[model samples]
Target chain A: MIEVAGGRLIAELTVRRPSFTLDVSLEVAAGELVAVLGPNGSGKSTLLGALAGLLRPDTGRIELDGRVLTDTTAGVHVPAHRRRVSLLAQQALLFPHLSVAANVAFGPRCAGVGRAAANEQARGWLAEVDALELARRRPGQLSGGQAQRVALARALAGEPELLLLDEPLASLDIDVAPAMRSLLRRVLRGDRGGGDRGGNAVGARTALLVTHHLLDAVVLANRVVVLAEGRVVEDGPAREVLTRPRSPFAARIAGLNLIPGTGCAEGLRTHDGTLVSGLLDAGVSGLLDAGESDSWDGAPAVAVFAPSAVSVFRQRPDGSPRNVFAVRLAALEPHAEVVRLRVSAPPGGPDWLDGLAADISPAAVADLGIGDALGDVLWFAVKATEVLAHPSVH
Target chain B: MVGVGLPVVLWAPAVLGFALVALPVVGLVLRADLVRLPELMTSEEALTALKLSLFTAAVSTLLTALLGGPLAAVLARSRSAAVRLARPVVLLPLVLPPVVGGLALLYTLGRTGPGGRLLELWFGVTVPFTTAAVVLAQTFVSMPFLVVSLEGALRTAGERYERVAATLGAAPATVFRRVTLPLVLPGLGSGLVLAFARSLGEFGATVAFAGSLEGTTRTLPLLVYQQREVDTDGAIALSLVLVVVAVVVVAVARPRVAEGAQ
Candidate 1:
């Protein structure tokens, strides 16, 4: 863990609305981009509002770069405009009356910078974002993708100490999203040609991104924090959290199947007292890292595997696979190059396998004829070698 | 709905509505003394009434913008109970008879009224039967147009952009000036035009509160009313002029007024 004393942004607060309450404690190191992922109504926006100083937390403090932005105990609530933090929302929302250049220069001009210097800075930032040609155009003239590019330039031209991004690329077209993503990667990585001037080297900035797309986390963020029902359920490095998610929400986002159980000698025992054997996850250092023994007897554990690992059959498969369950074919969805079958536990069977998915090729699906067998009981089997069981902290 | 044609049954009432609004102006144009129009419209009394109407409408529209602009902004952004209650009250003049509005103004600012007595006793000022009273009466009746238009514009514009500006380090005042005002500029323009047109057509309030006096308070509408008894042809000519100006103002403001409605 990075030193909390050296953290660039520290937010530990609780916000209460009429029907919901958000309690989150997050610390972002300098120059780090952390992606926040959650389902809807998970307080993702509330967290962003608090960080942006748009909503005051009912309790706790928000400290950024040693400045106390909000401290309920001390009664110090710095307003949003004075906080030097910028937010880029899903909509570009560029000023309709101002030219693209003026929109970008709005922040600098508000900060009392000279008009000419602010325009120069805007042009520089626009060029960095590869949108210099759009300087004279009005916002109405720009396409969705172009507008988002200008929005990024405007957000960066402010030289914010911390930037909050609320699904900035979610509204773009599928074809345009990748280009916007690449532009964000370039500007965020701060590897552009220009030398560091005006203290906007870009690499020195901290950012918190909220998104629902897994690709955004894998491509843009160094770390991932998952919230569920207004609580942080999983927080780790992006790859680790995505690959070995302990929370069901994170697993769903990562498109992996997760089974909650207690650790045993081989794999784990479900709540129904069924023993499911699997190999210990080699990626998890120490296997049981919390000073626990390798036995892992009765410890909280989870078995994670890809949807492709499970094989479906109409009749009971006579195989050497160590794990098998009787499941009902719940639903079939067409994934790219494959047909995904959502299976639930059959009557008088362990319920832990409900909602687990199995991905089979289209040809295999045709051969199995499961498309005509919805709600019929089928056998789902996974080899012990395919399952990776590891200690679950929560 | 985008490419569909209107129902055949709907065209009758639509045309009837159009005729209802358009036939009166057509009648006035037909009744005007075309050969003597130039002479009658350019008469001394007609010219003075036109000048006074234009001047008072201009001042009152300015006053509406200066005062009504901020009031609309506050009404759009504020959620206080008092503001919520005051909203319909502020728009009362839009529905209230202009004569009643003039009476209310008279009771508040007339020589025998409390505010008028205060002004006379302390400041030695009398407001009734003056050019200032004409401007005030015009402002009082026309203010609701500007306020309702601007408030709709502000609400339709929403606070999302304002929030974006604030996060970009713009102070509250700067956000209002730079982001909010420019965003609602079209609405403000339409509101001002509407207010100006309403002020130009003001008659009842001016007659009741300012007491129509030639060269001082008698505006175009009042002059038309006055000349109807003495010179019917002159009244018809001046009435045609008022209708032409109203048409021009409404035409200029129609597009932006539609935008604010959205």
Candidate 2:
């Protein structure tokens, strides 16, 4: 049962809603914080609800640390309160009527701890979250950030075995989110708080953080699991998944232009048979060189490049870049100091390669005189050296 | 902001509406004999009615809160068709004539009624024309106020905080006691006040169900009605007393602000 030192969760479930269905299989090792990244309505919160026992999946099994929380076939189910899982939502949602100290003590009090001991434990958790000074304040009196801090203390006061964070920083001010993020990172890693509590060994508790923000995944999660269309499309270490995303949603979050195709000797060939010539990423090259039995001739692969690497021209240039395509301007958006042009394949060109973003300097947009040329055929070029082609996971 | 400006013609009807409510009280005050006001108000019948009104109103308010609170909670959360259908029935007393409400209760618990017959056969209990009947009548008529106020409060306050509490290891009952109850306290406060005011002013229901027995069942409104036949001066003084009590209840509760605050 103790496959690893920490609590390990294995969930494979299908939840059907009116307009959408979520089917996902996921695993998170004990003490590991895995960020679930997806767009809205992509089943991110549904996954959290299933894990916290607030939702009952249509059919599946969810086992955490060898204890089955839900099993449709076995007719086993655990209610949310007894599941020993806590959730910190976008809003602080602190009990407005209770003092901050009492709010934090509420979990312990509900668990049948005596008043004095619960208060003492609450203070300890509050200090761990650096919110001890707010003990006497009511939830309504605190700022958004302070309230979130107290909410975190209250969530931890119960010593939950699993902590589900549903975009805890989403409601915070932009300027205050970074500080909270660092605090979350520290506490989730077990750098603070008493480590000797039951089911909460001397390290971080198992956590599944649902977020759409890439920064949250990069900063606080050990691994990133990307969801698209209610399925796990990408799951790997945070850095690897963010850098070489196979799903369009993941690529968008990572701020990269991704072209999906099949790998060949020269480069990747799109479904329309247009060869996007590029150099294989070092990881893919290493995998091929390791002498795996399967050949890479027609395996699924993706070519990714920074949007800044794309060069746009009104007319075909003389050099003829290896990755040049006849494209049409889709939309122009202001991205910081540059104007990002969203280009797509021209009328006669392959339609699969669409919505490719090219970020160019504002001066370049003026020099090229293409600022108002929406839907006009243009040339988008990227050097083979700039593109990193890797094997697609799905 | 432009269209929100009040038109000149609108103020006339609005002022007339205000005057309609204010003029009656002014007439009552003008007709009262100020020198004998204290004497008329302190009569034995008036004092008994006032005491009975306060006691019955207090007890009925407690009973309504105990039963209506859970009813409101269930109404707010339940999606079943039965609950949806029952919602209007729960609110029927609000729109139904108070006399009709009293008749419904009497028929349901009267000596010849099914529940009354069962109570008599099992425990030999008679529920009409007693002080307890006054309380029962008050609770029946006043329940809709508390239920409506609390249901709106529960809906406005939402289940998010309760869901959060459940995840934080609070059982369903604890979540209700600690989080749900406190979140809607302002709603509960105004509901209880409205119920108390309704109970205090109860007349028609008590007349039909409890029969205006002085000291035992006759409340303030019933006493004022009884006095109006033989002692018009005492009735007017007691009517003023009822008006004062209602005003105090409203002032203490601050219904508009407290109910809308959530």
| Cand. 2 Cα-lDDT | 0.87
lDDT of 2 at B247: 86
Q: Write the per-residue lDDT of candidate 2 for residues A247-275, one digit (tens) a residue.
A: 78889889899999888766788888888
iRMSD, model 2, in Å: 0.7
TM-score of each: 0.92, 0.92
Off by over 4 Å in 2: A1-6, A191-202, A281-299, A318-321, A333-338, A344-351, B1-5, B255-262
Q: Scored by CA lDDT, what does every candidate get?
A: 0.88, 0.87
Compared with the true structure, what per-residue lDDT tens digits does model 2 show for residues B124-150?
998989999999999999999999989
Instruction: Please list the Cα RMSD from the true structure of every candidate, rounded to 1 decimal place.
Output: 3.3, 3.5
- Give lDDT tens digits, candidate 1, residues B1-262: 4878779999999999999999988888888889999999899888899999999999999999999999999899998999999999999999999998899889999989999999999999999999999999999999999999899889889999999999999999999999999889999999999999999999888899999889988999999999899999999989988988898998999998787666
**Model 2 clash pairs?**
none
Instruction: Estimate, for each residue in A205-270, the C-alpha lDDT of model 1 and write its tens digit.
Output: 588999999999988888999987778878899999998888777888888888889988678888
Determine which window of 10 residues in candidate 2 chain A has minimal summed lDDT: A193-202
Looking at model 2, residue A138 earns an lDDT score of 85
